[model samples]
Target: MTSITRLFDFPYYQQDKYISIPDALVTKQNGVWVKTSTEEYISKANAVSRALLRMGVKKDDKIAIISTNNRTEWNIMDIGVLQTGSQTIPIYPTISEDDYEYILNHSGAIYCFVSDIEVLRKINLIRNKIPNVLEVYSFNAIEGCKNWVELLKIGEDETNQYLVEEQKNKVQTEDLATIIYTSGTTGKPKGVMLSHRNIVSNVLNSAPRIPFEAGKSRALSFLPICHIFERMILYLYQYYGVSVYFGESIDKISDNIKEVKPTVITAVPRLLEKVYDKIYAKGTELTGIKKKLFFWAIDLGLRYEPYGANGVWYELQLKLARKLIFSKWKEGLGGNLDLMVSGSAALQTRLARVFAAAEIPVMEGYGLTETSPVISVNDMRNKGFKVGTVGKVIDGVSVKIAEDGEILCKGPNIMMGYYKDEKLTSEVIIDDYFHTGDIGEIDAEGFLRITDRKKEMFKTSGGKYIAPQLIENTMKQSRFIEQIMVIGDGQKMPAAFIQPNFDFVKEWAKIHKIEIGTTNEEITADPKVIARIQEEINRLNDKFGNWEKIKRFELTADIWSIEGGHLTPTLKLKRKIVMEKYIDLFHKIYN
Candidate 1:
């Protein structure tokens, strides 16, 4: 039996030692669900390796993959590149062309594979700028562009299978597997160099935490495969013989979930927030008894305690709530979503409680791309689950809170270092512990609770330190605020630039018979809307210390998005970019 030490060994191990499912990987194409059996997946990946070898791909060669959505092709290509002892550079498709140029050049990627015409076009715009990128291939066949199928066709001869094997044998568990450029909120994206051991250890260690039913478990993967969180989970799925289905896109996830009926999925907090908001909006449209029951269930869910800590009467009420209201919530999310792993940012505790109460457990985890992503995750078994914390540190990983409160981690999962940036890497990884730059604490029970980003906490002019993330998370519980950034560094008081939840605000306007205008600018400018948002802030402010309360706020007319240069691809706010974009509003709040 092949040991799962290297990233490329996962599929082979699954096929030889585990159940080989006919639907190991499924992707929607032209409105039809296409299945790739474990046999076909391995065969195709082998062919990709042979083709790359034939094309002169050598050890340490870098290959860039830029995809608009998660697909089987990306996964196959990933394994293929790894088998050749080459590094896979996964780039986010939503980033600016300048970023595309920077990553390709910085990694010296010899060849680039794109998922669609749009990504190809972006590459075409800067083809000349990145001199090291030898060629560009598209997963989707495009006129005048090289297609990935051409490589598969070249490898169909199978004459060079021995060469593929030779290279695969040369690959080591500690060898660099991928260079994932972090879509950071500020500055250039850092290429996080992760080894096969870094990720394989994470998958193996994190697997026991997730209750997978082996071959019977199904997962709908919609998160970006470029990110280690999703990419590592894909390997874990393969390792556990879980059938993986790729959602068509973010907009079509609802429909795809119903079609796939996956037993589990991974998501970011922002996506979960949107899902909850959509469901809550629908509940508000209910009438009389149904409406009361819906809100009652929501309130009950917000107060949920795991392990029946709320006692037998509360458990009985929760049972009734699940049947009467929360059951529909489960059904709406495919009726089979038993677990969801939330990461990449802080998840609202209310959101976590409500979803778990609905019987769809969302296990929030914490890690950076450099750590192969999973350091700790909330697990349900053996009192391992916690309501607000990120759960206990995974097996084989050690975490300690620094005197300054930054979470320091040392584990097999930690990256080798940032690519070609030894000076920068030295500053973060000290005494074998990676300074996570996240302020957090381990409770007496061993649950890790993240408080804020080390650099994001700011001091008011009066010398009081304010952790904006805690305040922001609390404020976002309101249905009115969609996005917010608290800005008050070196200022007299803390203030915020808020992007209202337009959909919910419109619904609220209808309920109140208020005549707020149609456009975002007009709605933000309306005194009634401003006053109502202020009321929400005032109510939630009591949760914080006097120095940390939001003293003033200004609403933004436009939504903050990745394309708008206000958020990273991971959906974290680009604080510098956001502040620059909302300078006028910032001045209005402080002045």
Candidate 2:
């Protein structure tokens, strides 16, 4: 059996030495779940490699893929590009067209593959700008775009199999596998260059931390595969021979979860927050015994402690909660979900505890695109899990807290460097350690807890420092607050610009018979709505220092979203942009 070293070797490894199942990759097509076998997966990938070879693709050449969702075609194209000793540039489909032009030209990509017509439309808008791209292909056949099936037909002859083999053999584990452009909160995106070893080592090391039966577990993948967190998990799924079902889209995740009945999935904190809010909102609709039991279960969940640390009486009540109210919660998420790995941002500790109490554990991890993304993660096995922390560092990876509380990581999983920016790369990777730019501390038990982004922390005129994330995460636990950003970096006192839970406010208004208007603008401007939100702020503010508490705030009439230029693709607030967008609100709160 060939050892799995290169990124392309995962599928081949699964097919040859590992379990080869009939349903290796599944995708929902035309309202049906379509399965692609291991043999077919490899065959199509080889065909893609041969076709690229025929198209004059050479070693070190770049190919680009932009997809709106995770699908079988994306995986096939990824392996195909890597097999030809070429690097694949995976771009976020939601980014602006200017970014598309910059990345395509910067990477010197000779060919481009897009998932759907929306992506094709974006590419066509910048087609003239990206002159390096000789041709464009689409996974979904569009009117004027070249279809990927053409490549399959072009490489139908088996006579060229030896040439694909020649290229595969020449490819080393240290060779560049892909260039991932991070969706920065500010400025132009930097292309993070990762080698085959960087990702493969991360997969192998991080695999054991997640407990799943190799061939028996089914995974529902909805997160964008373009991100290393999800992409690495995809390769991990392949490595374990687990069958993967790609969700149609984010809007269809709940329905897809029901259809697939997957045992494991990956999620961001925002998605989980939405799920919890929806469930909580439904609970509010219940009355009498059901409503009492619902709140009882939630109260029990919020104080959850693992390893029977909450005592036997609490355990008994938790068992009752799980059997009654939490069981329905599980059913809503397809009933088979045993684990969810949360990354890309700090997950609220209460969300982690409550979900674990419901028997679906959310193991939150922390890392950036430069580290092949997994530095430390919470694992349930062997007491490696921690509620408020990001858990212990994975095996073969070492993490240390710097003098100023920055998390420094050193491991084989670290990226080679930022593509084409040596000065910027050298600034972060010093003394063989990658500076994570996140302020954190490793506990006595070795659990890492992130406090805030180093660059985001600020001091008021009073000379006391404030970590906005800590305040923001705590404030968001309020049912009335949907999103928030704490301000007053160099001002007199800490304040906030908030986007209230507009839907929840409407529901609350109905229950209380308040005369709040229907539109967001009218609702935000309502004095009654403002007073109620102030009550919530006063309640949650008791947990913070007086200096850190939000002294004043103004509500936004619109949702903060990626399309609004208020958030990054990963759902983190573009703080500068948010402040600029709400400058009037800022002045109203401070002045």
Candidate 3:
């Protein structure tokens, strides 16, 4: 695949003859998705840029966007910001108020964009703290603020057109494009400065790996656009002319998947886990021969290797398994899903193999916000793609394991540095290689396998090092376990604080005629429930050595989530916050 000939120029991508811009970019209108054609998209974006110029916005100014995936407006704002040689500072709509206040103040944003009236109210409440913000515009109409579309009318003023055109011509590959504040599972969010070169290089090189046939490939965008992984892919969609559909909301993905019938989609492991969990839960409801077949198909899936050759009989069994069982799984994912890319965290090897066996190719990749988010991805082509590894490093990127086993990468995709934090930047990027805190290994064929976070490994009282992530992942395989956090620092044995799959257990309690209380606390305290969880732990304990095995656990029906501060927006565990909140639970396990 050739590099984008125009290099770091984003606006120029609109002009590519090979890349067919659709008749309409989709957006919700009157409770139904509507399209605004390619010409309209360009005209609207250009008009918005002119409006910014009319508002006295200057080059290099920071414009903050506080919105969910309003695909049409978000892209228009992004291109508008680009045309003016200004930079966008995107804040996750779900972040804490204090965090939002910190980002606004720190970024020195002069103009802000919000998704709706509720978001506008949030900005209005925090307006005093962020004194530099001169104006707030709402994508949805609000009583107090300017509407985003009104800005387009400002661009129509003949006086502003010349300046917008002049500013658009000034955008260069080396110019600062955006400042992304990572939603770290721990500590304060740092702004990662990405230039046009950093993101464009990633998109152009990474786009080809994705099987996109112009006019045929459609993508359902659900991941937070604020995240680099989704944003980079958004650009790839633009470059390759893939029709994109914005999910209504996280809860509506099921309906949207069916409506869009996307050939390709991107997701985090948690979403895929939910899909698996739902299917597993349904399968558990079957009985006799049907129940046996369900589990049998699942077991075969876990053993199915795409690259390795199983015997003729095994292959035949797999074929039967796909027809009888796996076909239903595909239909659930909208019947057109050819590729589902999972990233932001390590996908469980079991899930990866099972999905591949079902003929739903899940390409698990690895990277962080700092690496423009894709260091490596499993190729859907199945040529040499490994299930457990994060595939071979992408073209033009060099990855190696440090002596300490941390994955270090150097490439055009690497961010310039931490915005306005040189000392912190120097700590991570040494001799041009960005030190990824993940501990991983490169196999002989060049696939990368991430084991655990370098800082997350803890030692037991017996002086044996244990990776909690490994234990947590293994334990979560149980249908009863929704989330688990392993705990044991200088202790006799490792214990876990677990969030139970309450709905699943509720059904089990009824079937067994085990009376339990209504609330989470009461349900978790039931003796029968405890016994059932113990059985699961005992089964999983076979996979680990005695030192690494979880000796005990405290179950809770309390779900961990991003809003609860127990999870990052990307769904990685916020271990520190979770530990602080559940000290008593941990004590119960250890005691």
- lDDT, ranked from best to worst: 1, 2, 3
Tens digits of per-residue lDDT for model 2 on 183-205? 99888989999999999999999
Give the TM-score comparing model 3 with the true structure, all chains together: 0.96
Candidate numbers, best TM-score first, in rank order = 1, 2, 3
Tell me how far the alpha carbon of residue 261 in candidate 3 is from the true structure, in angstroms, after superposition: 0.8
**Taking the tens digit of each residue's C-alpha lDDT, what string does model 3 give over 1-591?**
333432224434544544535633676666788776556777788888888888889999999998865478988898888879899998998888789898998888999999987677677778889999998888877786788888888887767778877886687777788999999878889999988888888887676677778655788888988999988887887676677788888898998888888888899988998889989889989999999999999999999787547788889999999999999888988998878888998788899999999988898888888988888888867574787888888888999899989999999989989988999999999999999999999988888899999889889999998888887888888888889988898898888888988887888888888888778888889888888999999999999999999888888667888889999888989999999999888777677
10 residues in a row with least lDDT, candidate 1: 12-21
**lDDT value, candidate 1, whole model:** 0.94
All candidates: CA RMSD in angstroms? 0.9, 0.9, 2.1
Clash pairs detected, candidate 2: none
Cα lDDT computed for each candidate against the true fold: 0.94, 0.93, 0.84
The list of candidate 1 runs beyond 4 A from truth reads: none
